[model samples]
Target: MFDRLFFVLGETFTALRRNLGLAFAATGTVAASLYLLGGLFLAYSGISRYADGLSGRFEMRVFLKDGITVPQIKWTAEKIRSFEGVRQVNWIPRDKAWEKYSKENPEIARGLENPFPDSFKVILSDLKKGDEVSERIAKLPATDPDGGVQYLRDEQNLIAQAKDALKVLGGMVGGLLATIAAVLIFNAIRLTVLSRRIEIRIMKLVGASYATVYTPFLLEGAIQGALGGLVAAGLLALTHRTIGEALKSFSALSQLPSLPYNDLTLALSGAGAFYGVVCSAAALYRLQLRYR
Candidate 1:
């Protein structure tokens, strides 16, 4: 077994050396493909974190009608508090609301009556139940008929749509690059097999098993893939560090979550190796040995 392993290793290296240009091309393609995929993963992760952060701060505003009485306001607040997932209900009287509005928009608030409605700022424990909570609050007797319960539903929907679009676009691009890489790997292995056809036939005639004949090519492809993955990982790490440093001066950008570099490296490397082995196997399968 040890001798066969040694032979496989030697043959693998020999073939790689003999087809250096093709091997390089295949490895480079694999690196580029995996790098692109890794970048997408990082970007998606960051966007997801940002979305979660925004969702955590989501608040529903229940606006009371203009002629709403104090008793009606109290009953409305009590009913909202009884709702599932309701965390806190803070009252914002029209006077205080108007004060804040005036401070923020002095020009607009000048010489205008307090147009702000008395409202309840409803905080939720679970963002997923936002729509349910909003619907219940909107049906309350004191809720304003014009604009009753308001939340960041439109903003949330936009974020969700953006995430979905990113996933679709990433999948399409990643798949195309992966297919190109696989084809390059297949062609590289095929060229190596063709170059050593005479030696392969002689080995077959000397009673070499299929495993003995094919193991070297398989290992060669794996090596190429692994090298490519390592290169891509290095590039990703460098980019992450550089961008992180550049964004440090921007407070908002710095708050974005960091990528899991260790996990990403392992995933990329393992995926590349597996992809390479599959492509090599495909090439060998298509070039079935008639000598056997």
Candidate 2:
């Protein structure tokens, strides 16, 4: 049994070697397909992660009512921290806020003469609860001293809208890539079937079982797919490294983390090989039936 298996493998290898040029061409095509698909997946993963990080930093800045004392500000911050969804409350002093603004926009800093209002920067466990937190903060007595705080959850709707828009855009991009991959693989396998029509017919005429003749072509397809996957993975890794180095020079991009090379490679390779084998089997089956 082992010897028979070896013989089948040997035959497949021989056939592949005999058509070295075609095999190389097919491998290149597979590699190119994999590279594009892998790149898209990697970008999707990276962007999704960055968006999550941004979401985690999404906090509500509650401006205090004018003329509030430091003790009242501290009391208000404590109250905010006690809210159900509140994870943390950071009291941004007027001076610190001014400093932050100055650092962020030097031109605006130079013109600023009036001090900005003090605020309680509330970080919530779930951003969706921004409205609830805002309502509670607004009811504080500091807004009227007697009773009537008027804080607004200004960033909540904007954050929710951005997240929804990004989700839709990501899905559309992924779907488009998937469609392109399907079309490319279909054409590749169709060409492979057409090119092997006569060879498959003679095997059927010799009374070969369907499995016996079809398995080798299926195996070849798998091998081709694996080759493509490896090449694509390697290219992706190289591209990622190159891009990361270039991005490091830019202060804004320096903080953004690139995808881990190993994980991305494994995912791309696995998906590429699976696509190859399935397309190969379908192509051979249809071609063999037509020839018979």
Candidate 3:
């Protein structure tokens, strides 16, 4: 196995050396393409996390009228259960509400009479629709006259805007990266096939099968993919660190989550290698048909 591995690698490098300029350019193109893809994915993950965190802060509290009986509360809740975009409608009984309030404001809990109200904490399917959902809940008769639906109306609107911005950025950047990857990989492999055309003909005359002829070029492509992937991973790590540091300088942005470098490195590198190998096989097979 080791002998075969070394032989394949030796032939691969020889092929690479034959077209050093093209090989290097191809590899760099692949690295740059993957780098852009990795950066976009990182931004996608960060924005998604931020949106989730913001949504977590929003829970529509439907405060009940003081005299509404427990049965009346259950009926009101049953109505809300069927409301659109309502994922979870939990009843926060008066005792539970008091417990939560007491922990947060122990002084207030000590001096105050039973000031906590019975409420339903509504978790929506999408927090971006908080305003609409809150509006619907406000009309219910059981809601407290003094306090109806409570939620962060403005923040939900902001989350919706952020989501829109992310969608636009992803579509544009992702499409460009895909185009560059396809063009560069196919062109690179075709150039490799062109460079080795003479050698392939010579091998065919010496009784070499297509398997033997194809192995060296395929191996070269796999190597190109690995090198490109690792280089791109390094570039992505550097960019992540630099940007993370810059963002950390602002206290408002300090909560931004860090990228999982190890996981991303493996994922991106594997994708790059797979692209190279597949492209190499396709280009070589086309060349074989042409030369036959």
Candidate 4:
């Protein structure tokens, strides 16, 4: 068993050495494809995490008409509280709202009348029900007729749409690159098989098993793919570190979550290896070898 393993390894290395240029081309293609895919994965993960955090903190603001009385505001709050999925409702008087605005933007507040309206900050237990709650609140008598209800659901929807577009675009590009890489691997293995045709026929005539004859080519493809995966992993790690460092200069983005390096590496490597094996198998399948 050990002898056969060593023999397979020897033949694999020999084939790789003979087809060094093709092997390198295939490996590089695989690396580039996997790198792009990995980048997309990381971006999708980060954005999803950020979106989830934003969703958790999402709140709806319902503005009341200018002439609304204190009693009317209290009544609106009670009605909102009775809505399903309503978690907590907080009332913000017009004066308090104006004060906050003035403190946050002193320049804008200069010589400006307190144009703020009385509002209720509505917190919901389930963010998915934001539109439903907003619809219900908008129909209230106290709600401002012109854009009384405001929530981050629209912004969240935009984010979700962006994520979907990105996924589709990335999948297309990655899939194209992966197909090119597979073709390169197939050609590399085919060339090696062609070069060793005589030897293969002799082995077949001598009762060599299919596994014994084909294992070396399969191993060669796998090695190339694995090397590519390692290269892509290294590139991703460097990119993550660079981006992390750059984000530190901006306080808002500094809290972004880091990429899962170990998981990505494993996934990339395993995927590359599996892809290579499949391509190699396909190449061998198409070949016609005869030993008489």
RMSD after CA superposition, every candidate: 4.6, 6.4, 3.6, 4.5
Ranking of models by lDDT: 4, 1, 3, 2
TM-score of each: 0.78, 0.63, 0.79, 0.78
**What residue runs in model 2 are displaced by over 4 Å at the alpha carbon?**
14-30, 55-58, 66-87, 90-118, 124-202, 205-207, 255-258, 288-292
Tens-digit lDDT track for model 4 on 187-287? 99999998888778788889887777888888888988888888899899998888888888998754647667788888888888888988888898877
TM-score of 3: 0.79
lDDT tens string, model 3, 171-262?
A: 78756765666566667677766776787678777866666677887777777776778788999989888887887789776554766778
Determine the C-alpha RMSD for candidate 3 after optimal superposition of all C-alphas.
3.6
Q: Which parts of model 4 have CA positions greater than 4 angstroms off?
A: 64-136, 140-142, 152-158, 289-292
Which residue runs does candidate 3 get wrong by more than 4 Å?
Answer: 1-4, 81-118, 128-132, 144-147, 252-254, 288-291
Per-residue alpha-carbon lDDT of candidate 2 for residues 1-292, written as tens digits (9 for 90 to 100) = 7875785677567556655666676667777767776676666566555545554466666777778899998888888888987788888787888988899888978976647777776776766677787688777765433323332345555556665665666567645654455445455556645565676677778876666666666666667667778898899888888887888899776454655767766776677678667877776566555436
Model 3, position 242: C-alpha lDDT score: 83
Candidate 2 lDDT (Cα, 0 to 1): 0.68
From the highest TM-score down, the ranking of the candidates is 3, 1, 4, 2
**Candidate 3: 10-residue stretch with minimal lDDT:** 283-292
Per-residue lDDT value at 179 in model 3: 61
Worst 10 residues of 2 by lDDT: 143-152
